[model samples]
Target: MELIRYAFVGVLNTGLGYAVIFLCMGVLDWSPVASNIAGYAVGFVVSFTLNRSFTFRSKGPARRELRRFLLIFALAYLANLAVLVLCVHAMGLDGGWAQVIAGFGYFGLSFALSKYYVFAEGAGHRDAGSTGHV
Candidate 1:
């Protein structure tokens, strides 16, 4: 159930991101790289809010959570950019199509990293399962 909600949020974010990229590059005649940067910036804010409040429901320190979130997203952004460059420039694909492919390509890895690293709690513990000791 939670995973479904998380996936829904991701889909929304992805749509928002792709729309911005497509509009900036397609309608406005911007470079793919420039449009991609703008699209990523906007999507980062949306992803942060949805993931923090809904997906992971993080209750950790705000500053730390934000920092970690940015860090993880930085990596994801790089991966996304690499995919875009390869698919668009190297393969001579359409910019919008390239971004579409990259978006799907990076989704799973981004989710896993953000779940386990960005919004995680309790000093890096992953043993979310309980021992029923109390």
Candidate 2:
């Protein structure tokens, strides 16, 4: 159930992020890299809010959770980049395909980090698992 909610939020985040990226690139004339950065910046806030409230149902200190979430995102992003680079440069894969593979890596890593580190069962003011609403 928790995983389902998390996946739902992820889908929302991905849609919004892609929209932002496309808008930036098409309308604002931003470079692809810049658009991607902008997309991720927006996604970060959306992901954190939804994951905390809807997915994990965390009653944690917002400040603490925000900080940990940021750390987890950074780590996951770095890992994703590493995989992308390895796939594209080392393995001679197509850039588009490499990005798809890297995205999967990022999703799995971010979900685990968010679940265990950012919104762990006992890390919150109330136990995350104690939320009766699921």
Candidate 3:
């Protein structure tokens, strides 16, 4: 199923994201939020590549796709930050645990925005079959 493939791709990206955050915070002494943001940036790069070439199998212009991906990531970044802060600051969760808690929401939001808008063919195309490729 396409959803299964999406999950697989997500797993890889999550690993990439976690690795970057772990290195930045655990090794370089960055703040948890700052480290998480850095990891998001790195993971975005990987996700854009993998989502286009492998996940969605997009057949579109690279420049346009990248621009759209960046736009979606900007929104996703805000969403991720909101979830993180809500979990950590409002809910009184540990920083690390908050990130884990936010990951599910991030995954759902990013996948929806990306599959429907960011990486879809042309502008705002919602061809589920075309966009949901492994």
**Best of the candidates, lDDT:** 2
Which candidate do you rate higher for lDDT, 1 or 2? 2
Report how far residue 102 has shifted in candidate 2, in Å: 1.1
In model 1, which runs have C-alpha deviations exceeding 4 angstroms? 13-43, 122-134
Measured with C-alpha atoms, the lDDT of residue 70 in candidate 2 is: 96
| TM-score per model over all chains | 0.61, 0.79, 0.65
Worst 10 residues of 3 by lDDT: 124-133
Residue-level lDDT tens digits of model 2 in 1-134: 77788889999999999999999999999999999999999998999999998888787788899999999989999999999999999999999999999999998999999888899853333554545444
Q: In candidate 3, what are the lDDT values of residues 82-106, reduced to their tens digit?
A: 9999988888999999887687777
Scored by lDDT, model 1 comes in at: 0.79
Model 2 whole-model lDDT (C-alpha atoms): 0.89
> What Cα-based lDDT does every candidate model obtain?
0.79, 0.89, 0.79
The positional error of residue 75 in candidate 3, measured at the CA in angstroms, is 1.3
TM-score between model 2 and native: 0.79
Query: How close to the true structure is residue 53 of candidate 3, measured as C-alpha lDDT?
Result: 72
